[model samples]
Target: MLCAYTKLGMMVDARHLFDSMGERNSMSWTTMVAGYANIGDMKAAKEFYDLMNENNAVAWVSMIAGYGKCGEVGTARRVFDEVVVPDASSWAAMESCYAQKDMRQKLLSYIQANEENVDGTDATVWGFFIRCL
Candidate 1:
């Protein structure tokens, strides 16, 4: 229900449903974060993200993408830095964020660093590098 409202851009209704959920799991929390992000409410998304007891990859990616969409690349970078184990989706989101800002040098550095640390880069990450280059 909440996800449906969120996807439909009915943020207020989605938020109400989110608030009504008695036992909000990680998916519920992530949906709220994504909802706020989808509505261009990065601050609200970040606030909800901070309040969560457990932050999953989807939540983190959504928050980071929200920050980027709001033109707060530094804040997104800080959030990325704090991620303990960033999955391909998280890295792809961050890469897209940087690419959107035309920060090619930073994107290259990030890809290089991730390649050195991780086994391989995801297709989206490679796409970011290719598009930026």
Candidate 2:
């Protein structure tokens, strides 16, 4: 329901429903964070992200994307650095952030590093890098 509201751009209603839920899961938190991001509220998203005890890939990606959406490349990079094991989405978000900031060299370095860390290269990562280039 909250996700539905968020998708509909009714962030206030989503927050109301979110607050009413007695049991909250990671998805719920992610939804709210996504909502904040959609509405260009990076501070609220970051705050909500901090409150979460267990952060999944989605949560991390949301924070990174939120920061990127707000033109805070430094914050996005910091979040990217904090990721333990960045999945494709996380890496893509970081790449996109760098691209948006016109830091092509840095984005290329990240792609190379990520490729070295993983046994096999991800096509999505390559695609993201190519798009940036």
Candidate 3:
């Protein structure tokens, strides 16, 4: 119900329903974070994300992609950079967003800075870079 309302752009209603829940899980929190991000409400998204005690790739990706989707690519890139050792999925998510935005130069610049972590010798990583272009 909360997700439905949020998807429908009824954040007020979504919040009301969310607050009424007796117990919450990662899905519940991620839903709100994704919802706010989808609407370009990065502030709200960040607030909800910060409230979470734990985060998985899905939660973090939501924020990275959300910032990109909102044209706040720098913020997205910053989030990606903050991860000491971003896994393949995390790197792929943000890089894909840059590709979608035609920000290939920015992506390439990131690759230059983080080559050690990106597994430059991996064919799959090369595949991702090719696909991005």
Error of 1 at 89 (Å): 1.0
Cα lDDT tens digits, model 2, 5-50, are: 9888898899899999999988999898888877878888888888
lDDT of 1 at 95: 77
| Best lDDT among the predictions, by candidate number | 2
Screening candidate 2 with a backbone cut-off below 3 angstroms (N, C-alpha, C), the clashing residue pairs are none
Question: Which candidate achieves the best TM-score against the true structure?
Answer: 2
Model 2 lDDT, residue 72, Cα: 91
- Position 115, candidate 3: lDDT: 80
lDDT of 3 by residue, 47-132 (tens): 99999988767768888988988878788987777666676777777877788788877777777777878777767567666765
Q: After superposition on all CA atoms, how large is the RMSD of candidate 2?
A: 1.9
Q: How accurate is candidate 2 locally (lDDT)?
A: 0.82
Candidate 3 residue spans exceeding 4 A from truth: 84-89, 120-124, 131-133
Q: For model 1, how does the per-residue alpha-carbon lDDT over 23-93 read when each residue is reduced to its tens digit?
A: 88888888989989877898788888989998888888888898888878888988887788777787777
Residue 121, model 1: Cα distance from true site in angstroms:
6.2
Alpha-carbon TM-score of each model against the true structure: 0.86, 0.87, 0.81
Off by over 4 Å in 2: 113-120, 128-133
- Candidate 3 collision pairs: none
